[model samples]
Target: MTTGAPTPTYPARPRRSRLRTFLPLGVAAWLVLEIWLLTVVADATSGLVVFLLLLGGLVLGSVVVKRAGRRAFQALNEALQRGGTPESGGGNGLMMLGGLLIMLPGLVSDALGLILLIPPVQKTLSRYAERTVDRKLRAASAGSFGDAFQQARIHRPDGKIVPGEVVRDQPGDEPQGPVPPLTR
Candidate 1:
Protein backbone atom coordinates (compact mmCIF):
# COMPACT_ATOMS: atom_id res chain seq x y z
CA MET A 1 0.00 0.00 0.00
CA THR A 2 1.52 3.32 -1.07
CA THR A 3 0.62 6.53 0.79
CA GLY A 4 1.80 10.14 0.57
CA ALA A 5 2.27 10.20 4.37
CA PRO A 6 5.57 8.86 5.71
CA THR A 7 5.59 5.57 7.65
CA PRO A 8 5.60 5.95 11.44
CA THR A 9 8.66 4.22 12.88
CA TYR A 10 9.19 3.94 16.62
CA PRO A 11 12.64 4.44 18.09
CA ALA A 12 14.45 1.31 19.16
CA ARG A 13 14.72 0.75 22.93
CA PRO A 14 18.18 0.39 24.46
CA ARG A 15 19.23 -3.13 25.42
CA ARG A 16 20.32 -4.07 28.97
CA SER A 17 24.11 -4.23 29.22
CA ARG A 18 25.96 -7.42 30.18
CA LEU A 19 27.52 -5.77 33.26
CA ARG A 20 24.10 -5.11 34.77
CA THR A 21 23.10 -8.74 34.29
CA PHE A 22 26.42 -10.22 35.48
CA LEU A 23 27.17 -7.97 38.48
CA PRO A 24 24.56 -9.61 40.72
CA LEU A 25 25.73 -13.07 39.61
CA GLY A 26 29.33 -12.13 40.36
CA VAL A 27 28.36 -10.87 43.81
CA ALA A 28 26.38 -14.06 44.48
CA ALA A 29 29.35 -16.18 43.41
CA TRP A 30 31.69 -14.26 45.71
CA LEU A 31 29.28 -14.65 48.62
CA VAL A 32 29.05 -18.39 47.92
CA LEU A 33 32.83 -18.66 47.80
CA GLU A 34 33.17 -16.89 51.12
CA ILE A 35 30.57 -19.16 52.69
CA TRP A 36 32.27 -22.30 51.32
CA LEU A 37 35.68 -21.19 52.51
CA LEU A 38 34.35 -20.34 55.96
CA THR A 39 32.62 -23.72 56.13
CA VAL A 40 35.84 -25.52 55.19
CA VAL A 41 37.78 -23.56 57.76
CA ALA A 42 35.18 -24.33 60.42
CA ASP A 43 35.27 -28.05 59.57
CA ALA A 44 39.07 -28.24 59.43
CA THR A 45 39.59 -26.31 62.64
CA SER A 46 37.01 -26.11 65.44
CA GLY A 47 34.46 -23.28 65.75
CA LEU A 48 36.71 -22.16 68.61
CA VAL A 49 39.41 -21.31 66.08
CA VAL A 50 37.04 -19.04 64.14
CA PHE A 51 35.91 -17.44 67.37
CA LEU A 52 39.53 -16.89 68.43
CA LEU A 53 40.37 -15.33 65.08
CA LEU A 54 37.43 -12.95 65.30
CA LEU A 55 38.33 -12.08 68.89
CA GLY A 56 41.97 -11.53 67.93
CA GLY A 57 40.99 -9.32 64.99
CA LEU A 58 38.71 -7.27 67.25
CA VAL A 59 41.47 -6.89 69.86
CA LEU A 60 44.03 -5.93 67.22
CA GLY A 61 41.68 -3.42 65.65
CA SER A 62 41.00 -1.84 69.04
CA VAL A 63 44.75 -1.68 69.79
CA VAL A 64 45.43 -0.04 66.44
CA VAL A 65 42.66 2.50 67.07
CA LYS A 66 43.97 3.28 70.56
CA ARG A 67 47.47 3.89 69.24
CA ALA A 68 46.37 5.84 66.17
CA GLY A 69 43.89 7.92 68.17
CA ARG A 70 46.71 9.38 70.26
CA ARG A 71 48.72 10.29 67.19
CA ALA A 72 45.68 11.68 65.42
CA PHE A 73 44.81 13.86 68.40
CA GLN A 74 48.38 15.15 68.52
CA ALA A 75 48.28 15.96 64.82
CA LEU A 76 44.91 17.62 65.17
CA ASN A 77 46.13 19.74 68.09
CA GLU A 78 49.22 20.81 66.14
CA ALA A 79 47.11 21.72 63.12
CA LEU A 80 44.75 23.76 65.32
CA GLN A 81 47.74 25.55 66.83
CA ARG A 82 49.02 26.27 63.35
CA GLY A 83 45.61 27.73 62.33
CA GLY A 84 44.79 24.94 59.89
CA THR A 85 41.96 22.45 59.64
CA PRO A 86 42.41 19.05 61.32
CA GLU A 87 42.06 17.36 57.96
CA SER A 88 45.04 19.29 56.56
CA GLY A 89 47.38 17.22 58.79
CA GLY A 90 46.21 13.94 57.09
CA GLY A 91 46.47 10.22 58.10
CA ASN A 92 43.82 10.48 60.80
CA GLY A 93 40.90 9.65 58.53
CA LEU A 94 42.65 6.68 56.90
CA MET A 95 43.69 5.29 60.27
CA MET A 96 40.19 5.63 61.63
CA LEU A 97 38.76 4.03 58.48
CA GLY A 98 41.20 1.12 58.81
CA GLY A 99 40.20 0.60 62.40
CA LEU A 100 36.53 0.61 61.44
CA LEU A 101 37.17 -1.93 58.69
CA ILE A 102 39.12 -4.15 61.06
CA MET A 103 36.26 -3.97 63.53
CA LEU A 104 33.92 -5.38 60.88
CA PRO A 105 33.30 -9.15 61.25
CA GLY A 106 35.05 -10.26 58.04
CA LEU A 107 38.53 -11.63 57.27
CA VAL A 108 38.72 -9.67 54.03
CA SER A 109 37.95 -6.34 55.76
CA ASP A 110 40.44 -7.19 58.47
CA ALA A 111 43.15 -7.82 55.91
CA LEU A 112 42.35 -4.60 54.07
CA GLY A 113 42.25 -2.66 57.33
CA LEU A 114 45.65 -4.09 58.34
CA ILE A 115 47.06 -3.00 54.98
CA LEU A 116 45.55 0.46 55.35
CA LEU A 117 47.11 0.75 58.80
CA ILE A 118 50.54 0.58 57.19
CA PRO A 119 52.18 4.02 57.03
CA PRO A 120 53.09 3.95 53.35
CA VAL A 121 49.65 2.73 52.32
CA GLN A 122 47.98 5.36 54.51
CA LYS A 123 50.09 8.11 52.97
CA THR A 124 49.36 6.86 49.44
CA LEU A 125 45.65 6.74 50.16
CA SER A 126 45.71 10.22 51.70
CA ARG A 127 47.43 11.61 48.62
CA TYR A 128 44.94 9.84 46.36
CA ALA A 129 42.04 11.28 48.36
CA GLU A 130 43.52 14.76 48.12
CA ARG A 131 43.92 14.44 44.35
CA THR A 132 40.40 13.11 43.99
CA VAL A 133 38.99 16.03 46.03
CA ASP A 134 41.02 18.50 43.98
CA ARG A 135 39.77 16.93 40.75
CA LYS A 136 36.14 17.06 41.89
CA LEU A 137 36.53 20.68 42.98
CA ARG A 138 38.14 21.65 39.69
CA ALA A 139 35.46 19.93 37.64
CA ALA A 140 32.62 21.40 39.69
CA SER A 141 34.04 24.90 39.77
CA ALA A 142 34.60 24.95 36.03
CA GLY A 143 38.37 25.75 36.16
CA SER A 144 37.86 28.59 38.65
CA PHE A 145 40.45 27.15 41.02
CA GLY A 146 43.07 26.91 38.30
CA ASP A 147 42.37 30.39 36.99
CA ALA A 148 42.18 31.94 40.44
CA PHE A 149 45.21 30.05 41.69
CA GLN A 150 47.25 31.26 38.73
CA GLN A 151 46.28 34.87 39.28
CA ALA A 152 46.23 34.73 43.07
CA ARG A 153 48.77 36.94 44.83
CA ILE A 154 49.00 34.55 47.79
CA HIS A 155 50.34 31.82 45.49
CA ARG A 156 52.94 34.12 43.88
CA PRO A 157 56.57 33.06 44.31
CA ASP A 158 59.47 35.39 45.25
CA GLY A 159 56.96 37.54 47.24
CA LYS A 160 55.97 39.56 44.19
CA ILE A 161 52.33 40.32 43.44
CA VAL A 162 50.89 40.63 39.95
CA PRO A 163 47.28 41.34 39.05
CA GLY A 164 45.79 39.46 36.11
CA GLU A 165 42.54 38.15 34.67
CA VAL A 166 41.84 35.02 32.66
CA VAL A 167 40.62 35.46 29.09
CA ARG A 168 39.01 32.45 27.43
CA ASP A 169 39.74 32.27 23.71
CA GLN A 170 37.83 29.76 21.60
CA PRO A 171 39.00 28.77 18.14
CA GLY A 172 36.82 29.40 15.04
CA ASP A 173 34.90 32.18 16.76
CA GLU A 174 35.16 35.77 15.47
CA PRO A 175 35.66 38.62 17.99
CA GLN A 176 32.36 40.21 19.02
CA GLY A 177 32.82 43.82 17.87
CA PRO A 178 35.06 45.90 20.19
CA VAL A 179 35.76 45.56 23.91
CA PRO A 180 33.40 47.53 26.11
CA PRO A 181 34.62 50.33 28.43
CA LEU A 182 34.96 49.58 32.14
CA THR A 183 32.13 50.98 34.30
CA ARG A 184 32.51 52.13 37.89
Candidate 2:
Protein backbone atom coordinates (compact mmCIF):
# COMPACT_ATOMS: atom_id res chain seq x y z
CA MET A 1 0.00 0.00 0.00
CA THR A 2 1.19 3.54 -0.68
CA THR A 3 2.12 5.18 2.57
CA GLY A 4 3.69 8.27 4.03
CA ALA A 5 1.44 9.41 6.82
CA PRO A 6 -2.10 8.08 6.72
CA THR A 7 -4.60 10.81 5.91
CA PRO A 8 -6.39 12.00 9.03
CA THR A 9 -9.73 10.23 9.34
CA TYR A 10 -11.48 12.66 11.64
CA PRO A 11 -13.12 15.87 10.44
CA ALA A 12 -11.49 19.18 11.25
CA ARG A 13 -13.05 21.44 13.86
CA PRO A 14 -15.53 23.95 12.54
CA ARG A 15 -14.51 27.62 12.46
CA ARG A 16 -15.83 30.02 15.11
CA SER A 17 -19.35 31.23 14.57
CA ARG A 18 -20.78 34.75 14.75
CA LEU A 19 -21.16 34.51 18.51
CA ARG A 20 -17.40 34.15 18.86
CA THR A 21 -16.97 37.42 16.98
CA PHE A 22 -19.10 39.31 19.51
CA LEU A 23 -16.81 38.70 22.47
CA PRO A 24 -13.82 40.64 21.11
CA LEU A 25 -16.03 43.46 19.90
CA GLY A 26 -17.56 43.75 23.35
CA VAL A 27 -14.12 43.87 24.92
CA ALA A 28 -13.00 46.57 22.54
CA ALA A 29 -16.03 48.71 23.29
CA TRP A 30 -15.37 48.41 26.99
CA LEU A 31 -11.77 49.45 26.45
CA VAL A 32 -12.89 52.57 24.61
CA LEU A 33 -15.27 53.53 27.38
CA GLU A 34 -12.49 53.03 29.95
CA ILE A 35 -10.18 55.39 28.09
CA TRP A 36 -12.85 58.08 27.97
CA LEU A 37 -13.45 57.84 31.71
CA LEU A 38 -9.77 58.09 32.47
CA THR A 39 -9.41 61.24 30.40
CA VAL A 40 -12.34 62.91 32.13
CA VAL A 41 -11.18 61.95 35.61
CA ALA A 42 -7.56 62.92 35.03
CA ASP A 43 -8.57 66.32 33.68
CA ALA A 44 -10.87 67.06 36.62
CA THR A 45 -8.43 66.14 39.38
CA SER A 46 -4.85 66.95 40.48
CA GLY A 47 -2.07 64.43 39.90
CA LEU A 48 -1.80 63.45 43.58
CA VAL A 49 -5.55 62.94 43.88
CA VAL A 50 -5.65 60.81 40.75
CA PHE A 51 -2.80 58.66 41.99
CA LEU A 52 -4.40 58.10 45.40
CA LEU A 53 -7.76 57.26 43.90
CA LEU A 54 -6.33 54.82 41.42
CA LEU A 55 -4.20 53.14 44.09
CA GLY A 56 -7.17 52.70 46.39
CA GLY A 57 -9.33 51.41 43.61
CA LEU A 58 -6.67 48.94 42.60
CA VAL A 59 -6.26 47.61 46.14
CA LEU A 60 -9.98 47.20 46.68
CA GLY A 61 -10.62 45.72 43.27
CA SER A 62 -7.83 43.21 43.64
CA VAL A 63 -9.08 41.89 46.97
CA VAL A 64 -12.62 41.52 45.72
CA VAL A 65 -11.68 39.97 42.41
CA LYS A 66 -9.26 37.53 43.99
CA ARG A 67 -11.85 36.26 46.44
CA ALA A 68 -14.42 35.93 43.72
CA GLY A 69 -12.03 34.05 41.48
CA ARG A 70 -11.19 31.60 44.25
CA ARG A 71 -14.83 30.91 44.98
CA ALA A 72 -15.69 30.43 41.32
CA PHE A 73 -12.74 28.13 40.73
CA GLN A 74 -13.72 26.06 43.74
CA ALA A 75 -17.26 25.70 42.45
CA LEU A 76 -15.96 24.62 39.08
CA ASN A 77 -13.66 22.07 40.68
CA GLU A 78 -16.50 20.67 42.73
CA ALA A 79 -18.67 20.27 39.65
CA LEU A 80 -15.86 18.48 37.83
CA GLN A 81 -15.37 16.17 40.82
CA ARG A 82 -19.03 15.24 40.60
CA GLY A 83 -18.58 14.14 36.97
CA GLY A 84 -20.18 17.24 35.56
CA THR A 85 -18.71 19.75 33.16
CA PRO A 86 -17.29 22.72 34.98
CA GLU A 87 -19.16 25.94 34.52
CA SER A 88 -17.35 29.05 33.36
CA GLY A 89 -16.61 31.58 36.08
CA GLY A 90 -15.83 34.41 33.66
CA GLY A 91 -14.69 36.33 36.74
CA ASN A 92 -11.01 35.58 36.38
CA GLY A 93 -10.91 36.71 32.81
CA LEU A 94 -12.97 39.77 33.60
CA MET A 95 -10.64 40.57 36.45
CA MET A 96 -7.64 40.47 34.17
CA LEU A 97 -9.51 42.49 31.59
CA GLY A 98 -10.38 44.96 34.32
CA GLY A 99 -6.74 45.23 35.39
CA LEU A 100 -5.75 45.93 31.83
CA LEU A 101 -8.44 48.54 31.50
CA ILE A 102 -7.29 50.15 34.71
CA MET A 103 -3.72 50.28 33.50
CA LEU A 104 -4.80 52.26 30.47
CA PRO A 105 -4.96 56.02 31.09
CA GLY A 106 -8.72 56.38 31.64
CA LEU A 107 -11.38 56.35 34.37
CA VAL A 108 -14.34 54.99 32.34
CA SER A 109 -12.70 51.78 31.27
CA ASP A 110 -11.45 51.14 34.77
CA ALA A 111 -14.90 51.60 36.24
CA LEU A 112 -16.58 49.35 33.69
CA GLY A 113 -13.91 46.71 33.90
CA LEU A 114 -13.92 46.83 37.68
CA ILE A 115 -17.66 46.38 37.65
CA LEU A 116 -17.22 43.32 35.46
CA LEU A 117 -14.65 41.96 37.91
CA ILE A 118 -17.22 41.88 40.67
CA PRO A 119 -18.32 38.38 41.60
CA PRO A 120 -22.02 38.69 40.93
CA VAL A 121 -21.61 40.28 37.53
CA GLN A 122 -18.91 37.81 36.61
CA LYS A 123 -21.12 34.93 37.76
CA THR A 124 -23.90 36.06 35.46
CA LEU A 125 -21.48 36.46 32.57
CA SER A 126 -20.00 33.08 33.33
CA ARG A 127 -23.43 31.46 33.23
CA TYR A 128 -24.04 33.01 29.84
CA ALA A 129 -20.69 31.72 28.62
CA GLU A 130 -21.49 28.23 29.87
CA ARG A 131 -24.82 28.20 28.10
CA THR A 132 -23.19 29.31 24.85
CA VAL A 133 -20.57 26.59 25.03
CA ASP A 134 -23.18 23.96 25.84
CA ARG A 135 -25.35 24.97 22.91
CA LYS A 136 -22.45 24.76 20.45
CA LEU A 137 -21.40 21.36 21.75
CA ARG A 138 -24.95 20.03 21.54
CA ALA A 139 -25.34 21.28 17.99
CA ALA A 140 -22.10 19.67 16.89
CA SER A 141 -22.91 16.38 18.56
CA ALA A 142 -26.33 16.20 16.88
CA GLY A 143 -24.83 16.72 13.42
CA SER A 144 -24.06 13.81 11.01
CA PHE A 145 -20.31 14.06 11.55
CA GLY A 146 -20.83 12.97 15.13
CA ASP A 147 -21.79 9.52 13.94
CA ALA A 148 -18.84 7.19 13.36
CA PHE A 149 -18.39 4.54 10.67
CA GLN A 150 -16.80 1.12 10.75
CA GLN A 151 -15.09 -0.70 7.86
CA ALA A 152 -15.43 -4.45 7.29
CA ARG A 153 -14.04 -7.05 4.85
CA ILE A 154 -16.11 -9.58 2.92
CA HIS A 155 -14.46 -12.97 2.05
CA ARG A 156 -15.24 -13.13 -1.68
CA PRO A 157 -12.52 -14.12 -4.13
CA ASP A 158 -13.81 -12.23 -7.20
CA GLY A 159 -14.74 -9.22 -5.05
CA LYS A 160 -18.01 -9.12 -7.01
CA ILE A 161 -20.15 -9.87 -3.98
CA VAL A 162 -19.83 -9.76 -0.23
CA PRO A 163 -21.51 -12.00 2.31
CA GLY A 164 -22.57 -10.55 5.59
CA GLU A 165 -23.79 -12.63 8.51
CA VAL A 166 -24.51 -16.33 8.16
CA VAL A 167 -27.33 -18.23 9.80
CA ARG A 168 -26.17 -21.71 10.69
CA ASP A 169 -28.10 -24.71 9.31
CA GLN A 170 -29.56 -27.03 11.91
CA PRO A 171 -28.43 -30.69 12.19
CA GLY A 172 -31.54 -31.99 10.32
CA ASP A 173 -31.28 -29.45 7.47
CA GLU A 174 -31.11 -30.89 3.96
CA PRO A 175 -29.77 -29.36 0.74
CA GLN A 176 -32.06 -29.19 -2.29
CA GLY A 177 -31.04 -31.34 -5.24
CA PRO A 178 -29.79 -29.37 -8.23
CA VAL A 179 -29.24 -31.36 -11.47
CA PRO A 180 -29.40 -28.38 -13.89
CA PRO A 181 -26.12 -26.64 -14.78
CA LEU A 182 -25.46 -23.21 -16.31
CA THR A 183 -25.05 -23.23 -20.19
CA ARG A 184 -22.70 -20.87 -22.03
Top model by TM-score, which number?
A: 1
lDDT per residue as tens, model 2, 78-120: 9989999876554667676666655455566567767776678
Choose the strongest candidate by lDDT.
Answer: 1
Tens-digit lDDT track of model 1 for 1-184? 7668776575587998999989999977866765676677789998888788778888888887887789888988988999987767357778887988787666777888989988899888888888999999878788666676775644344445665567787998888899886332
Against the hidden reference, what TM-scores do the models get?
0.57, 0.44
Q: In model 1, what lDDT does residue 83 have?
A: 100
Give the poorly placed runs of model 1, Cα more than 4 Å off. 1-34, 87-89, 143-184
Looking at model 1, the pairs that clash are: none
| Backbone atom clashes (below 3 Å) for every candidate | 0, 7
Question: Model 1: what TM-score?
Answer: 0.57
